[model samples]
Target chain A: MQLSDSLNQLIEALRCQPGIGPKSAQRIAFHLLERDRKGGTQLGSALTKAMTAIGHCQTCRTFCEQPQCDICLSTKRQDSGTLCVVESPTDVLAIEQTGQYLGLYFVLMGHLSPIDGIGPKEIGLDVLEQKLSQGGINEVILATNPSVEGETTAYYIAQLCHKNNVGASRIAHGIPVGGELDLVDGRTLMHAFSGRRVVTQE
Target chain B: MQLSDSLNQLIEALRCQPGIGPKSAQRIAFHLLERDRKGGTQLGSALTKAMTAIGHCQTCRTFCEQPQCDICLSTKRQDSGTLCVVESPTDVLAIEQTGQYLGLYFVLMGHLSPIDGIGPKEIGLDVLEQKLSQGGINEVILATNPSVEGETTAYYIAQLCHKNNVGASRIAHGIPVGGELDLVDGRTLMHAFSGRRVVTQE
Candidate 1:
């Protein structure tokens, strides 16, 4: 707080990051100005360019610089019948890293939270409904997390797909693949039990 | 890495921060663009301003916005006879925060490592020698950390002060104030015993 006005301002602005606090902000600001001013300038200009150029993809609501995201336009990822619906663009990246599931995506960006007045339309659910009604997608995989808001949003999307005559399924909620039995939480255990599967002999 | 081009560029540039890696950089970039683009813009502009405006103080080599740093220009801190020579500007801040020392400071910005080609001139030791020759300073306190390079730098500075007829002293190396005896290392314990203070009867 005893730094120059501009430096203090930069530190303050850096705290807008999700996990960054005053100490981290100050450290980052000082590091940028003291050790890497050229990179700092590049970061500043890049920040402006990214913010100014990026917007929601028209088809999936994922962040992109064009009308549609590359994922939506790719012929390589042509599994259009199976769409993975997620809560945010970061989820898209997480799924993309697996190099599996060559399908389209729908980024809600947020779940339906009635108390905060974030309803279906606020997160582009209308766009999703329109896509479903167009009769191309055969299965809608609800990849939203198992929290209350996420569950509610998934249920609403599922009901919408059912009304539109498209198959809808929620992503399974259970113990993680590499999880230990004793370490798993109660809710996860319950879901894992409820979602039990049987092995078939061919 | 599958993020949009500008977002990926921003993430890559964020790696220039001292301790940040790919994961934290991506999280920071996504957080900035997704939830706080306005703040991102402010931070970008603030970086440009701070980088453009800040310069080293002529006398102390500490960051400043003008010809000299605030500490160097302040008339209240007039104990120019007792000077603290430290390795970096952060060291000056640390000493100033204690509110115990009231003296001018000289920041070297780095230690003296001869093999790496960082000799006296690289760290502006000649400028310090010139200051010492001016005859206003009476005692020079070396507050460098207790390390091979730091001790060497301190010894070299102490010799310069001694040659100029000025008193030279080093900050003590001992067990930290709240350190537990069992947890402290052997070398620190040895220093604690060596620098033991005498008890005076009340």
Candidate 2:
């Protein structure tokens, strides 16, 4: 039997999510209608509000409802004079959860990919250059992922930082803390060995 | 760092979907904001419209925007005098996809589970009884799931149909087509043996 138009529309629309497929979309639609109408209504309003209202921060390009993000507006982070560059807003969240970094973030929103036509401007590198040239930031921490595209993007940003006479350092690439040495990939092992630090220089 | 209020709320509201966790919610939120704002907006409006407008069909108790679902209103299905009772709307979709079972459906929405406080009335059995007593249905197919609760519910509904002088039959349960006997679960194998049909009469 044909589903109602509204239900069918909702199911079709749900395919916009990253991993959901047709079956999953239908399941989710039925779940909301059968069990969680209140949650569905709340999600609808939330999606509407976020989609229309949320935009990139003027300074950092991370998602925000206002002109600037919270971290960018904070005086403490500003005083630190260190900028952490990353590929996405979720990376900002991951770093923030660590509570180790006290600096503003410049979210690239995506990595540089020449094949897909994504470049400096597409990932907002022009904005990053402007931020670097403005001269408040003493250092830039490239925290992009370890993927090839992420590396290319980080290297490009590092070049920009150097051109502006700012110190740029990449986040370490090594085996995870709890990961077994044998399980680590060749590249990671090589990087770990090459970048090893002397704990006790006796 | 604290996400913007709208962004955070969107993430939280997204967790209402089955199988979505906090991390997936955040990922989906960022994905929508970054890549598919138009799709997200469409989904939001569709969700809002569906959640508010769709209601249980008065005839079959299935989800629809009208008093009667399309299948129930169809003259062909109505004339069949066969009503298939199921546990959810998705089951109706599944049955319909097969191009078989061209009959009306009564969605129970759930099965009887007294431990969880779900009773016959909760699954819309009263409405089903009313439909049965109205004197047009010749047979009621118990297509509820084969679980214990489903069996109990089917038995209850079958008794109701008997009282209303309507025929009741349970859907067959056995090994799936193309399923190997060795791989089939013991219960299913037992069912296959017990419910064996005489294909040819010597």
Candidate 3:
């Protein structure tokens, strides 16, 4: 039997979520309508508000309601001299969750995908370059993934940092912790070996 | 770095989707805000509209924009004396997709989960009893599953049918199509064997 027009439309609309298929969309739609009406409104209001209120942080390019993100504005964090450059705001969150990196961040939002017409300008490289050129930043830690596009983007950003007289470093690539050697990919092992650190005598 | 207030709120609100955890919620929140703004708005508006407009079908208890669901109102479907009773709205959709059962449906929404304080009245068995007494349904197809709670609920409804002088039939329980016998559960196999039908000479 055909569902009501609104329900069908809602089900169709829910497919907008990443990884959501027809079955998942229908399930989510029904779950929202039948079980959590209040939560549905909260999600709706949040989406509506985020669409209008959320934008790029002026200094870091991360998503935030204000012009600058919380990381960029916080004086309690480590000195802004060391900046971590990443592919997306999610990457920033991942690093922050470690509780290790207390410095600031620069989110590129996307890599330099030339095939898709996504160039340096598309990811606001000019703005990042301008910030680097102003010259207080001492080092740039390129924390992009080990993919080809990530390497290229990191290299490009590194060149920009060099021209601005700022030190640049790429994050080490290696097999994940708790990963077995046999299960590790060959390329990752190669990277881990090449980037291995030397032990110092006591 | 802590996400902005709106972003955090959105991530929190997105956990309303069934099976979505903190990680999936964060991914979905970022996916909507960063990449699919228009689609996010569509989902949001759809969710909002559905929360207000969608309600229980007076006849079948399935969700619908109108007082009666489309299945309950359709003129093309068979107006036979048969009525199919399912455990949930998803079940109704599942059965409807088969395009086989031409009869009307009555959704119980849940089984008799006594531990959860769900009794016959909680799942609207009283209303179903009232409908049965009005006297148009000649046969009730108890399509509820063969699980403990489902069996109990079906038995209760079946008794209601007998009181109203209506025929009650349970959907056959057997190994699923394309299922191997070795993988089939013991109880299901036993039911399949006990309920086996005799072959007629063609």
Candidate 4:
């Protein structure tokens, strides 16, 4: 290739992003080089700063520049005494977008995949247990994904919550609100039937 | 979003890439933060170095860290006295990968789009004309894309080559080598018929 060494290095480095292959990496590199050098410079500084400064919040394990995240530090969220556990930081953002759940969050960062060597401690369950044993939180909501690993991780965390005398509950599993029953998968339809709520009483 | 400041900035900066949207940007940010901080750091440095260090080659207008590209400086290619004019650096890379072309390239960076205010000067045609006048090149191959703007740019460059007594020819346009004739578009099929070459004597 006639590409300069720095440009080639830039293309190679761009592939580090998820879902960016060789073609996409080359496109991005050229786009930045040709049209968006300022944007490229901005992204470079942003990546450098984030990679160096961002760290897991001590209280919840979600990414935060400080020891504790803004949500954990907020008096209202802390006093609410409800902690929602999730697999990643994005899930925390998804739940926060609803604005209905005004509780704090505990990001596991990953699920309990024993095959991949991810255990309870790896997901920060020990820190969660310590927080539960400290005795201020009243409820722990398991908002993990509905995959096998997520379910196993939730169940283990529930057991830990019970050990510390705190109530633990998994989020409901059912067909999506806007989805048709027939279009839903079999297991999801079953969950919808079993978890059905009574409407307007008798 | 509950994302920290640095993390949020990183996500925002990631959207500057060509095809990445908000969702992809968030996914990339979370992925780097959760699993590949090292890769993220490498990409950061690479971007910074490339954005600051890489500049256009004086001879070809393609990306290069120094004054001229390696291909432009190579004695064998310099003495070949044949120049290939292309729309972008990627096209040069594509042609080089074919292993048939040994001549050097002149990258226009983009085609002429009058609506976007791009003209001869913007695509660096003046430099190309000057190079043509310098008298080392014998043949100038116009390898721009088959789009209307690409055609216009190629025609303009061909005129410049003729003015300077250099032979200019456009690359062939037809259905791809392995493609079915039935699947080919009308204009391409028409071009194939008009540009057909003779076979061995019957």
Query: Candidate 4 chain B: minimum summed lDDT over ten consecutive residues — where?
Result: B1-10
Q: Give all candidate RMSDs, comma-separated.
A: 1.9, 1.6, 2.0, 1.5
The sequence of per-residue lDDT tens digits that candidate 4 reaches over residues A38-120 is: 99999999999999999989999989899888899899999999999999988988888988999889999999998999988
- CA lDDT of B176 in candidate 3? 92
Model 3 clashing residue pairs (backbone): none
- DockQ for model 2 equals 0.87
Q: Please, what are the lDDT tens digits per residue for candidate 3 over residues B13-65?
A: 98999989999999998998789999988887887887888889888898877
By TM-score: ranked, best first: 4, 2, 1, 3
Candidate 2 TM-score, C-alpha based: 0.96
> Which consecutive 10 residues in model 4 chain A have the weakest lDDT in total?
A1-10
Tens digit of lDDT per residue, candidate 1, span A43-154?
8788878888888899999899889988889875555688989998889999989888788899998899989999999989899999999887899999998899999999
Q: Please write out the lDDT profile of model 3 over residues A1-202, one tens digit for every residue.
A: 7788888988898888888899998888888776788999889888888888899988889998888877888785436589899999989988988999878888989899999999999988999899888877899999987789999999999999989999999988888999998899899999889989899999
Write the residue-wise lDDT of candidate 2 on B1-202 in tens digits. Answer: 8888999899999999998998889889999999999999999999999999999999899998988999989999999999999999999989999998898999999999999999989998998899988888999999999999999999999999999999999999998998888999999889889999989977
Candidate 1's fnat? 0.64
| Pairs that collide, model 2 | none
Clash number for each model: 0, 0, 0, 0
* Positional deviation of residue A170's Cα in model 4 after best superposition, in angstroms: 1.2
TM-score on alpha carbons, each prediction: 0.94, 0.96, 0.94, 0.96
After superposition of all CA atoms, the RMSD between model 1 and the true structure is 1.9
Clashing pairs in 4: none
